[model samples]
Target: MSKVEITTQNNTKKITLSGHFTAMDHDQFRAILDDLQSGEGCTACAVDLEHLEFIDSGGLGMLLLLRDACIKQKLALSLTNAKGDVLRILDIAKFDQLFKVVG
Candidate 1:
């Protein structure tokens, strides 16, 4: 199961994603993206992956989608709190340079 909690403050949106980000979590991921995109005015967005347990290629694709969407919308998007295996994946995929990884 996947659990994605979102917290919004001012123009910044924080998405705390946990659990396996795979085919099963596609809907949840999509919903989160939809909600963020639907906001009236958002200047920044951050996805916190510190609690993420497992991620497959699908998860990576989801991240890419969000990144692209944010870029097109001129929103400052960042990923934070990645550790261990998750950090490795982002490094291998060269996503660390493509997106801002903080904390």
Candidate 2:
């Protein structure tokens, strides 16, 4: 949650996050999560984590929250381009059971 960029076009929404996702960025991420949960717009969503440098337990929690929101709203959500430590952390958390991840 170092930097977050969100874009929407043609009913598709994408959120790109870079740097570190940890407790320090909780507030910022929660805002984004809230927007998604509202789901006033956007038919599909993807989180691009190709440039993410790090992640912690708090970050994982945010991810779970996102998954739940998407499910509740019935929106298609996925994570893409995860690798290195980011990928490892997600694997350790068995996030594959919760969200569609592609690299």
Candidate 3:
């Protein structure tokens, strides 16, 4: 199972992802992003992956989806606090080349 926690501060919407990020949780994450897309009025978004435990190719696809969502909504996106396996996966995918990733 996976957990998604969202918070808004000033112009930023932060999404903290926890647990395994697999195909099973795709819809839940999509719904959460949809909610953020619904006139939430944010100018930036951060995905906090510090607590995330695992990810697969489906998870990578979702991250791409998030990137597109942010671009379409004219929001800056950050993938932050990623460590261990999460960080490794992102690095292996070279996602840093595509988005802003921060510790």
TM-score of each model, paired residue for residue: 0.91, 0.90, 0.95
Model 3: residues with Cα > 4 Å off, grouped in runs: none
lDDT of 3 by residue, 1-103 (tens): 6798888889899998999998888999898779778736789999999899998889889989999989989999999999998899999999999989999
lDDT of each: 0.85, 0.86, 0.90
Candidate 1 vs. true structure, TM-score: 0.91
* Cα-lDDT of candidate 2: 0.86
- Model 3 clashing residue pairs (backbone): none
Provide the clash count, candidate 1.
Answer: 0
Tens-digit lDDT track of model 1 for 1-103: 6688998888888898887777677788788888877866889998999998877788889898889888877889999998888888888989978899997
Lowest summed lDDT over 10 consecutive residues: which window, candidate 2? 33-42
**Candidate 1: misplaced stretches above 4 Å?**
none
Predicted candidate 2 versus true structure: per-residue lDDT over 29-62, tens digit per residue: 8898777766667788899999999999988898
